[model samples]
Target chain A: MNLLRTAREMLEGTSYTLGIAGRTALALPQLWRRRRETTEQCYAASVKLIHVIVLVGAFAGMILSLQTGLALADFGQEGSIGSIVAAAMVREMGPFITAVILAAAVGSALAAELGTMKVSDEITALEVMSIDPVPFLVLPRVVALTIACPLLAIVANVVGIYGGSIVAESLLRVDPLAYRETVYDVLARPAELFPFPKDIYAGLFKATVYGFLIAVIGCSHGLRASNGALGVGEAARTAVRNSIILVLVMNFILTRVMYT
Target chain B: MSTAASDAGAAVRFESVEKQLGGKQILRGLSFEVPRGTSFVIMGPSGSGKSVTLKHIVGILAPDAGRVLVFGREPGQLSRSELASLRSRIGLLFQDGALINWMNLEDNVALPLREVQRLPEREVRPRVAEALERVHLADAAQKMPSEISGGMRKRAALARAIVSRPELLLYDEPDAGLDPATGGSINRLIRRVQRELGATGVIVTHSRSCALTVGDRIGIFEQGRMASEGTAEEMATSSDPRVRIYLGIDGEATTERSDSRGAEHGTGATGR
Candidate 1:
């Protein structure tokens, strides 16, 4: 019984969250009008998060490079470690870390802030003023995250790939020049539909999707909060948990669709 | 059976409106009318659905049955734009101020004008300044909500509510958490706004001072319905035992458990 109830609530929450996004799309014209607020949110989403992205990205690349190099070294193919690390970071880890950091850090804060506003009657106050919260509050946040996610993912890819190359050269005894040449060769592989390689474009696309999902989930949870402080706390927690789940699910689905 | 509209005619009319929230009936066949250009006070014990009624007037919450009419049109029947138009003509002061914490006092007050009125920036500033001056918060214009005192926050919210010069003003427990002096200042500001704007005011409050000082007609609510209504004089001299008991004028309920917190909208508060 409890499981069924929880499932029903999850479905309802997802439906409402998407409903908010749909409404936000209808209010897109207002985005240009409210560009100042959107720009501020973009700065907030990116600048506050750059440090975490760099730290996570660097560690992710270093680990992948070290593991791949040690295994390949047994076969006397350690020179190929740099290429594998580049492929993994560009196709997966870079976007993954970006999405995780955004969901855990920024999404939670958005949810908590909005949840506090809802419980305290500030949201109702906006409605009373004939101001739709969708246009005024949700749109800027969604736009900012959607735009920030891809750009930040690119930064992660660069830093992570560089970290991996360093690990390959120093830890695995692969020649530094050879490692760099192989990494470049992998990225230089012919592309079909985009300027960048399929892996690079696909990962950025995934990050963008994750960013949009995080903002919608966060805003929806916040708007639904009631009962006060405990409710606000729950909203923030749910935003992070649900965003990460959705990101992983989307990542798998996108990987299967694009690569296959 | 009782009516609460001022003698001038109904600006807002609730005809046997029934609303259920969280599986509990919060407003049970409730009915009342509020006339234009007068201060009407809805005084009730906590959880008596006073604030809910205020929300209904602005179309924030719709009744489950019956009708809620503002300006002879049902708020529930209006289109989104129409409802917004109606809401634009009204201003609401929330119980805890509800000022957006991110914005400074000036921006907060300027919201109605900037967002609703869509006025130019030049037009918004002077009106905001004027509203702040009225509430005696002119010096705190640049301060964020977190930087201000609770009383100042309430005053700033009031300024925001009136900056648009709305035709109808609603107050929900306008002095909920304030010192006596601050509450008194708020009460005085509320009266001044009503007198100066000639706007219809529906104030939902438990403060005896608020009801008596500002109300032209005072209605007492009991369990989602109006128990009685009259001038402050009539409320004080009321003959109905229920009215006297509720007003605590007759000292009847002091004998009971003393803490009869009525049902909350959700926390199992139901109409008797």
Candidate 2:
């Protein structure tokens, strides 16, 4: 009986998520209609995270480069650290790390905001005023996140590659000239393994999909919130947890589809 | 002292409506009507489906059984655009003000004008100022709702409700959690707005003072059903035990009171 109940809940949750996606798609035109609102939301979503993104990206790149360089040293392949770090950052860590940060910060904020509105009757007020809350509230947040994530991921990629270079020069003692040459060779060579630019494109695609999914999860949990303050808190907690798990899962699937 | 039916002149009418929420029956065979250009008050204890009934009129919730007609059109039967059009003609003041916390008082009141009416900023500004002035919150227009007092918040909500000059107004406990003086003033403002706009008004309250003050006709709800309905005078002198108990009137004492005195003083101090 418990298993059946759990299965029913999972089905309901999936159906609800799909329904929100369809509604969000239909409400896309609202982004154009409410351009100022969309822009403001985009600014709010992205502006405060610049410092955090830079720090996380740089640290991730340094740590990955150091670990990979140490492992390769035993095999006398330490000089190849730049190529490996750049490829991994471009293909996976950059987008994944950025997504995790945004899921915790912006996604949870969206859920809390909409949940409070639900509890306060503000969403009902919009309905009473004949303004659909999906178009008025959800559309702007989704569009803003979609536009912000790719841009943030680009920043993460640059910082991560720079950090990797620094670590390679300082800790690995790989010749700076040799590291630069390998990075350029990896990115510039069209026939290299994993190829030039494909991994970068894959990273950007993952970022965009992650952004869209995070917004959907946050908004859906918010709109479904009931009970009041406790309900709002639960919605925010659920949004963050679900978004992180989905991002990791999606990262794997996207990697398989892109590389294989 | 009977269930009012929908008439050609009625602004809102509920016919044998029933609603269930969370596996609990909230409204059971409920029925009432508010005539155009008059105030109809539904007085009931808490959890008696008063708010649910108001939601049905706005199409926020649909009835599980029976019909809700607003402006002679069945709300549940309307298309999306039709419902939007119908809702634009109505204004609702929620119990807790329900102001958007992100926006300050002026912007909150101006939202309907800018969004629903699609008015320009220049026009919306003056209209917002006018609404604030009417509610005596003009000086506090720039302040957030949290910065204001409870009475001010309620007044701000009232300002938003009347800003668009809606033809129908629904107020959910306009005087809830208010002191008697403040509640009285809010009731008076509601009456004044209704008269000035010549709009149909429906108010749900548990306060007999509020019902008698604003209601041209009054309906009492008990246990998700309309127990009885009548004018202020008729309700005060009603012989129904439920009505007597709900009104807090002793049957013998009410009988000894002159009909004129009951009618004159039935609404308490706010009536004048």
CAPRI-style grade of the A/B interface in model 1: medium
Please provide, for model 1 over B88-133, each residue's C-alpha lDDT reduced to its tens digit, 9 standing for 90 to 100: 8888989889999899999999998989889999898899999988
Task: Provide DockQ values for all models, in the order shown.
Answer: 0.78, 0.77
Winning candidate number (TM-score): 1
lDDT at B53, model 1? 95
- Across residues A169-207, which tens digit of lDDT does each residue of candidate 2 receive? 999899988887877766664533555567677788899
TM-score of each: 0.92, 0.91
Best by DockQ: 1
Q: What is the C-alpha lDDT of each candidate?
A: 0.85, 0.84
